[model samples]
Target: MHLAMIGVGYVGLVSGACFAEAGQTVICMDVDPQKIEGLRRGEIPIYEPGLEDFVRRNVAAGRLSFTTDLNDAVDRSQVIFICVGTPSREDGSADLHYVDEVARGIGRTMDAYKVIVNKSTVPVGTARRVRRLVSKELARRGLDLEFDVVSNPEFLREGSALHDFMQPDRTVVGVESAKARQLMAELYRYWTEKKFPLYFMDVASAEMTKYAANAFLATKITFMNEIANLCALSGANIDQVRVGIGSDSRIGDRFLFPGLGYGGSCFPKDVKALIYMGKTMGYNFNILEATNLVNQAQRHRFIFTIGSFFDHQLDGKTLALWGLAFKPNTDDIREAPALTVMERLLDLGADLRVYDPVAMLEVQKHYENYPYPERIVYAPTPEAALEGADALVINTEWDVFRQFDVSRLKNLLKAPVVFDGRNIYDPAQMKQAGIHYFYIGKPIY
Candidate 1:
């Protein structure tokens, strides 16, 4: 199959590479010339784990390519995957201009029958909207070309996107016609042959599935955080509660970990988008609304706990912050709880020495326009971040942070105080090491 992936961002790039690795000829198209040129030279734009190697390997094998010209990609490919970003607007609705532009370009450039797949996370009616835009463009060009707009949303996690793409639990495809269904089945035959489930549904259902899945996961995380907070007040251990409930077969545990709430590219944006979507339909997603409020409050609550420790006086405190990328194994800081903590702490007049494996550069860029960028120092290592700091604040729960030498941490910090937002450390262990440890869902030790 010849595939053209429009908009070579995270989803587009990962999907295109994975499809190419599956033996399809994939040409990834993007508007940015520099990004396309970088891909040509084996330089990947995003910091997804194993993505660069996957892209480079596929390019070396001649199964993958990059192009800045959309027309060429559309003309040469039999399958056009609209994988552009549907960024959330201030109104919480998905901004679909990029998807619209790609659909119009495809309508203008496609010369024969093509299977146009919507792989981007969009609203329920977006697939139909794309179909109408394509039809309108074809009418303007006075060409009666047949094309099928299929909704095939991606469910790839950021850190383990390659694995998720290749080994999805199930694939949901929304097709309008039997022909479109057959084409999509053929495209995913590799996975289907291996018994990976491929579910076919209506376009609207498929679109709603993505939003529903993300919103539910966000709600689950928020619910867990709420439970953790209540546990803290009632002297209950969230870990024991989590294990107790997680062992239930009916409520299989995932996303039940108590943390600084859910923050990443998908959950927060999708939850907000779902809320806005409900409002547009004259329906209220009360649980989701509360979920959003709770998620945001979770971050503030952690910040307040930190402030209360200092008697609300945080002026001139040097703190060591570990972890910056929303989660570990990726450099994506969008909507990260760490950023919220850093900004709030800085507002409280504290100096921070932060360190992350790969997200330091991204955080530095994020703080470029801040009023006082010099207040936050990017440390070279975790130990360096702890040097002369009054307390240690754990944000991202990277594996390196878990393997830290507790004695060394106690020795390095000016004060043996630790605020663990991710609950990565054990309270008993901290107490044994003679370190003051404060974590989520437990009494401070």
Candidate 2:
């Protein structure tokens, strides 16, 4: 398969690399020349586990390449994947201008039959919109080109993107024509041969599936957070509740762990986009609305608990903060709870020493224009962040943070007090270690 992944962002870069590794000839195109040059020089823009090695190996094998010229990519590929970002607009709908631009470019440059796949997570009916845009552009050029638009939404997690791509639970492809369907099947024959499910449906359903999956997961996390908050108020343990309920065959444990709430590039944006879509169709997603409100409140609730512990006197406090990325194993900080916590703490006149394995540089860039950038010191290591700090705060549940020695943590902190947002540590263990511990949805130990 000759694949052209337009937009070498997180989705495009990962997908292109994976396809190349699967023996497909892939050309990843980006509008940014600097990014294209960097990729050509073996510089990966985003951090995903095993992505750099995967890209490098494929590039070395001459199966993968990068370019800034969309025309070149369009001309050389049989399957063109629109893997651009569908960022959330002010109205909470997806901004599809990038997708539109790519569609127009493809129509202008494509002289033969091509399978144009929507690999980006977009709203329902975007495939038809892309088809219309392409037809309009081709008509203006006085050129009649035969092409098919297919919706093949990607269901990838940030930290485990490569694994998700290679070992997908099920691949959903929405196609309108028989030709497009056969081409998609042939493209994913590697996974299909391994007995991984490849589902074919209408384009709208495929688009809806992506949004529905993310929204439901977001709602599940929000529900758990809600239950955790109630457990705390009612003198019950959320951990016990989680296990008891998770063991039920109907409610298998996944996204059951409660924390500062769900925050990532996909969940927050997808949920909002779904809600907006509902409004547009004269329908109301009441549960999703509550989920959004509760998720945001969960972060503030954690921050408020911290403030109350200090009797609202957070001034002059030096806090040790762990985790800057939204989740573990990825350097993406979009909508991360750590950002909310840090901003609120800074507003309250508290200085923070923060550390994440690979996200410190991102955090530094994030705070470049902030009023109190100096107050948020980027620590070299987790232990270094804890040294001489008033207390430790865990935001993201990275594996390294989970393996910290209790005695060492106690000795390094000015006070042996810890506020665990991710509930990484057991309450009994913290109690036995003689450390004052606060965590979500549980009695303070």
| RMSD of candidates 1 onward, in order | 1.1, 1.0
Error of 1 at 219 (Å): 0.7
Model 2 clashing-pair count? 0
Quote model 2's TM-score: 0.99
Give the whole-model CA lDDT for all candidates, comma-separated. Answer: 0.92, 0.93
Model 1: residues with Cα > 4 Å off, grouped in runs: none
The residue pairs found clashing in candidate 1 are none
Which tens-of-lDDT digit does each residue in 1-445 have in candidate 1? 9999999988999999999989999999999999999999999888998998899899999999999999999988989999988888998888899999999988888789999999999999998899999999999999988889999999999889999999999999999999999989999999999899999999999999999998988898899999999999988899999999999988778888898998988898899899999999999999999999999999999999899999878898999999999999899999999999999999898999999999999999988998887788899999999999999999998999999888787789999999999998888889999998888897432
Worst 10 residues of 1 by lDDT: 436-445
| Top candidate by lDDT | 2
Residue 89's lDDT in candidate 2: 98
